[model samples]
Target: MVSIEMIVAARARLRGHARRTPLLSSPFLDEIAGRRLFIKAECLQHTGSFKFRGGWSAVSALEPEVRARGVIAFSSGNHAQGVALAARLHGVPSVIIMPDDAPKLKISNTRALGAEVVLYDRAKEDRDAIGARLSEERRLTLIKPFDEPQVIAGQGTTGLEIAEQAEEEGVSSAEVLAPCGGGGLTSGIALALEARTPGFRVRPCEPEGFDDTTRSLASGRIERNATLSGSICDAIITPQPGNITFPILKRLAGPGIVVTDEEALRAMALAFTRLKIVVEPGGAVALAAALFHGEQLQEDAAIVVTSGGNVDDEMFARALALRG
Candidate 1:
């Protein structure tokens, strides 16, 4: 399990490396939601996602000799770029295993960040087996996307920041919503808020079809998504929540929030138009919940953590076309 102490230490390591993205607000958004709305623009973080914090935390926590041997991670896109760039910054080699159908921008960005990119068929090949083979062959450290303690601890730093930011914004209480995949970010934030701000609660947000985390929370056990590759919110789509992360979420997180793919796109469009922040569909899920699912929320103020902004130009154009 991830502890607040671990999160604090991760923040110390990330002080110079990771960005402290701002907490932003728009009156227009507040009016639409009929409550105060704040956006934690993590999309502006390094590698255009919050995954960089976890990447740096895990890589930096490794022993010098071990880290020098390099690192490996399997991600659809966001985590791949994060680990790739973190490895590059540490002067270590990185091997990224990605789905062949992952966004072109993410694949190219990972390569440009100086990692060896290996493509696999998401529908047929097993990414874990491939990662295992390559890690053994190259003596590379495998960074599990969400299950690792260091990664979860690193992600918790965002919650710490939110706590402080909320205090600064005079928000004594609010529901903090974050896009959920394997529950790393959601659980990490939950742990942080569990200690830092008892009044605040963490909520996991997801697209309608890939609501495994949401269902898992309600059922008190892990649940798997029927299909993983069907949503435009692919960044937050996972087979199920992580063993380490699910337990944390079950203990500390509030009920999960589900939004439609179209709702996510509309949130992205609103973010672009109102805040001028480009958000990917998966990244917009939390904001979508805050905006469109107000009836499900229980606070006068809502804080949304926009997870990533790594969408392709064409996909971004499609989001903007919604204009909702």
Candidate 2:
């Protein structure tokens, strides 16, 4: 479904549009990790997550006439904001279907970006079904959160940055840790690292109970999460890995990693104090694994993506409290 060429093409499309988010390192974090730690702080990206890259890629790939027809998408939050913002930028109309339980900040931000917001009960209703109905009724093009070739290629650009940035920093080989929802980010990074920076690895990181990608990798097939409504990492509570994304991840990624909400919160706290940045729970998972599950990672410098920073005030406070 994707390749390094696609990632390169997507990166060209994203230049001057997407921020080439810089990699950050900290002495404190290094002490905690006992290895060199570089954070690709995509939390600083537009729309507060890497989703913006894929969203823009999908929107930008649309034919001019088709772009005028507008687009629809389903996201718990990050992708919603991304598509909304991308549509606004391209002067395309957008409608986003989001769960009622998604973070209020994310919902509000999405709407503020000018997309119509549709709410659904995550437990009682199927977001995709609702989105499909809307798409059919409105004739809006549907841009999925992940699972699309353009989306995966767009997300892969982050890995391109990691490889180039690491080399600039004089690092030879590294294992990458990225937050996993449906494996878009992980798989995309895997493809890029495999091509541009041989020997570099991508590992999927997820919340404990919702670690479907982890289990799926173990069994060599896709598996569903028993419950998705729980994790504090709301941004990445996808039920299973995407069909297109799974194969790439299965081939290039290392063993999956899991961290608890507590660990995620603590990692968020650490990011704030050590990195001087705010990170949401889902965004902190990779860093959480780096900080708390180090034993499981490859014996090399770790490059972790603190994927986003769109948390609600209350939750951000709770994450900060863990610091004390």
Q: Pull out the clashing pairs in model 2.
A: none
Residue lDDT tens for model 1, 1-324: 578999999999999899999999999999999999999999999999999999999999999999999999999999998899999999999999999999999999999999999999998999999999999999999998899999999999999999999999999999999999999899889989999998889999999989999999999999999997889997998999999999999998969999999999999999998999989999999999999999999999999999999998988888878763
Report the C-alpha lDDT of model 2 over 31-76, residue by residue, as the tens digit.
8988889999999999999999999988998899988999999998
Best by lDDT: 1
TM-score of each: 0.99, 0.99
In candidate 1, list every pair of residues with a backbone clash. Answer: none
Candidate 1 local accuracy as lDDT? 0.94
Clashes of each: 0, 0
Which parts of model 1 have CA positions greater than 4 angstroms off?
A: none
Each candidate: what lDDT?
Answer: 0.94, 0.92
Alpha-carbon deviation at 36 in model 2, angstroms: 0.6
Candidate 1 lDDT at 39 equals: 100
